[model samples]
Target: MKIISEKCKKCLVCIDACPVKAISKKGEEVTINGDICLECGCCASSCPNNAIEYE
Candidate 1:
């Protein structure tokens, strides 16, 4: 899953929605740590702005 910065509103919902705790905020950018990500699309679903893309 990748976060689209243009679409992201910094809601921080994806951070809490991640089951593996892979999502984090850094310097105003909400990012998903690929190392801990499960690719379950949890963060993608939680994003109201459609900023998270899971491929």
Candidate 2:
């Protein structure tokens, strides 16, 4: 999973949707701790701004 460009609006939609609560905000950006991420793709689907990308 990766964050797209610089379009993240810090909406926190991805953070709330994450079942493991793996998404975290630092400054104006959000990041997912890979170790805690379950690769469930829930965050990607939930992001309204299409900021999260899973591969």
Candidate 3:
């Protein structure tokens, strides 16, 4: 999965939706830890801004 930073609103919606807790936030920056990500597309689906994309 990938995060389109331009499209991200930093809402952290995807973080709540991530089952693996792979998403994290620092200040206004949100990121997905690839090593912990399950790639289940849960984050992608939950992104209201369509910031997360899955392969």
Candidate 4:
């Protein structure tokens, strides 16, 4: 599974890249709901800042 790190810039790109819609934004913070995530790696691949990582 992957998680968003402190390096995130709130671009919200990962949210859109996630095929399972597991990535979410609450205020300025973006998060990935592991239970709903498909672990397809799309969010990590689309993250321009390399904020998403395997944990």
Q: Single out the weakest 10-residue window by summed lDDT for candidate 3.
A: 25-34
Q: Write the per-residue lDDT of candidate 1 for residues 1-55, one digit (tens) a residue.
A: 8999999999999999998899889998998899989999988888999999975
RMSD in order of candidates: 0.8, 1.1, 1.1, 1.3
* Tens digit of per-residue lDDT, candidate 4, span 1-55: 5554578988899888988889899777888898998788888889999888887
- Residue 12 displacement in candidate 2 (angstroms): 0.6
Tens digits of per-residue lDDT for model 3 on 1-55?
8888899999888889989899999767788899999889999888998888874
TM-score of each: 0.94, 0.89, 0.89, 0.87
- RMSD from true fold, candidate 2: 1.1
What number of clashing residue pairs does each candidate have, in the order they appear? 0, 0, 0, 0
lDDT of 2: 0.88
TM-score of 4: 0.87
Residues 1-55, model 2: lDDT tens digits: 8877486888898989999999999887799889989999999999999988885
TM-score-based ranking: 1, 3, 2, 4
Give every collision pair in model 4: none
Could you give me the TM-score of model 1 versus the true structure?
0.94
* Superposed model 4: Cα runs more than 4 Å off: none
